[model samples]
Target: MTEIVIETRSGTLAGIGEAGLTRFLGIPYASAARFEAPGPVAAWQGTRAADRFGRQCPQQFGGKVRRDVLESETYGEDCLYLNVFRPEGGSVGPKPVMVWIHGGAFLAGGANAYDASRLAREGDIIVVTINYRIGVLGFVNFADALGLPAIPSNIGLRDQIAALEWVRDTIADFGGDPGKVTICGQSAGSMSVSLLMLSPRARGLFHGAVMQSGAVSLIHDRERSIRDARRYAEALKLDQSRLQRLKTMDIADLMRAQAIVGKQLKNAIPAAPWYDGDVLPASFDEAVATPTAPVPLLAGATRDEVRLFDLMPGDILPTKWDDLKGLLRDQFGPEQTARILATYPRSRKGRIALGSDLTFVMPTRHFAERHARGNPTWFYRFDYAHPLVGAAHGLDLTMFWPFSGLKMALVRGGPDKGRRAELGQRMRSHVAHFVRHGDPGDIWPRYEAESRKVRIYDLADSFAANPEAERYAAWAGRDVEPGRGK
Candidate 1:
């Protein structure tokens, strides 16, 4: 095996080179105590082996679907590490960098799950995937609610910022152009990209962004976040006054308490980024209305973003037309519900479409629309779905990283295997183009208010003017219901 050594700000790292690509895995960007902001990693004299993936942040597998993807990996608290993949050959100048953040509803997933060698080779760019704290340890708001100044809020986001800071300071040694860095993510990670776009701490860290199947609507209000923290504390049998006990609690106990609280709240853990007013603005609307960084963005969602959740065993699915209408009324209220129902047909497929739009598609469009007002933006809709599942959530991941053995079956199960591979390559090429240049090539038009065009990705990829325009119009200027946006 070919091995190479590179010097970074923290220390000297030894990595392996293969297939015209070099990989540095599990390099620490920063170190931090539990529930504290990340601090710089101290320089070490000896070269550290970055051959294996770092331990994933402590997490639990929630269901079969999650188990299928996350259960095989080991996890731990000291998970603030990132992996770097770059072309082996030297270039005249540094290449563009793409930092990826994984998605698992802010509860599960880590950097190890993704292999960036293909993206690095194909795009001829540097790829960095990060591992950050998730669930209670990362997102629970305890500083203000419990009156504990020691407990830092939004530590997960802080970890991401620390990783970006590392890239800004050290990527040049690895042949990456930090000045042209692009931050990309899916689901919760996409939400993170949007939040970082507005975060003062994340300013100048990245020049562009790509958000897939997520948007700015996932953030919770401080009140809601504090309440969830209280519930978590109660599950741990600790009062607000005894919050210090959490610092010394066993990792197993902490995870068990998190699971208990998650179950009690019907899996609605309040463990998400919140509007701290300092780190994040009050609302997504406000943040996008006046962006702190007006960087070009590529954002969109799949045709069935919520079908993945619905496929799980739950009584949440509507049985009939009346049940669907009632569900809509309960979520959007009577007046807006009437408008939505009028715009959408009353059938199982139609209900699923509505759910997809409310949860992922519409929020993405809203953020894209507001962001387009100032900066260049491109939007897309992933329409290809495997025969087994129809355009489900996270299905687009198969297109981005098709070589992954874990995802190959999911992408190749449908008819025409060769055709699917070709499509996946096309999608990756588009992403590579976006990372190299701000635009997504000439075929995809920049989103504008006058022409709400979107690139549709299917067997026959094409551009369309305002796909599902009328349905989106129904929810315009209306307050999107809570829980529906997730």
Candidate 2:
């Protein structure tokens, strides 16, 4: 391996050359204190070695040890880093850029978990993976709860905007076209991308967006945000008199408080992005009706998103019928809830369908419908089933890049492995095309209001016009308040 140096506005970075790509890891995009907006990174004197992954943002282990959690034990509060991957001698000038944001339910995820080398080389595009603050440090609205006007409401989203600003300012040096940047993410990250489309501050940073299994559905309203902050402060034993102690407290103590608050609110993420009028729209209705940034969009959800929740402990989603009913009723009320419930059968399948549609499917399709009204939008459904869990919540993730052996086996354990690999390639090709030309090629038709065509990704791919129209009809007029019930 050899070193490749690139000069940026901040300083010089030395990346390592791998098999067929050059990788620059652990590049700091911005820096921030506990609850403040991100600030510019301080310039360095000499060339900085960026050969290794950076520390993940400090987060709580949510009752279960998963793959990303085990990958690294070292984490810190100052964890605003990103990574870049570019193909070796692929194109003459700048290539289309794809920026990836990972999803951990707005709580626990990092940038180092993903390796974008293969995606970059095969697609002939530059891929950037980023990290931002999560959990209490990022999402909680301490600004209002503690009368601390200096703290920001959406620090996590601010980190994302800062990272995008860094990309816009510095990507050209890394053979990336900042003008053709496409933002892609899954779950909470996907929600961030969708929310960014509505954020005035994030307007020209991206030209395209791809959301997988998420949209702006799980965000907290202002009351919920402030209530959560109070709960967090109470868990930390910090009243207004002791508010100053929060910044100096150990990160472990904060994590423990986060975990405690998470357990208290069963079947829900304790902290999430709130509708702050500054960074985000002031109200849920305004956010929903706000015209999104004029960018081509490719968004979709898997067939059985809720099934994966059953296998995990401490379910973030409502897996039981009563819990799902309460949540929908909490937002949609009795009559609308009854209309939605009448569409499905009363069984395990019905529970999965109800929860999946309520949590992921309907919200994603709703966003696509709104986006398609003014901009180019392509919608899809991932139908490739896992041997054990069917087409689960994160099944689309495995198709995009190579994962660990255990994850691959658990998701792709059944027959037709070769065909599944081929399907993954097709999906990536569509994404690469979208990143280049702002469309996912001609084969996948645009989602229109009349037909509502959707591309279905399965062992044998096909197209459908308005699949599950009945369920969509049920959720048509309902503008349910997001993050109402646990």
Evaluated with TM-score, which candidate comes out highest?
2
Q: How many clashing residue pairs, candidate 1? A: 0
Question: What TM value does model 2 have?
Answer: 0.95
lDDT of each: 0.79, 0.86
User: After superposition, which runs of candidate 1 have C-alpha atoms over 4 Å from their true positions?
Assistant: 63-73, 313-333, 406-417, 477-486
**Residue 285 in candidate 1 has what lDDT?**
53
What is the lDDT, from 0 to 100, of the residue 482 in candidate 1?
44
The global Cα lDDT (0 to 1) of model 1 is 0.79
Model 2 C-alpha lDDT per residue in residues 1-486, reported as the tens digit of each score: 999999988899999997889999999999988877999999998999989988888776585323333224457776899999988886688999999999999888888878888788888899999999998889998888878887887999999999999999999999899999999999998999999999999999999999998888678888888888888888887876665688878666777777787887767787899998999998888888899999999999998998888887786777788988887788778998898999989998888888788788888999999999989999999998877788889888888777767656566653325887788788888988898889998578899999999999998899999999998999983544447522
Q: What tens-digit string does per-residue lDDT give for candidate 1 at 282-381?
A: 6555665656477889999999876787775432223245654665677568988888778877766887787777667887788888888889999999
TM-score of 1: 0.92
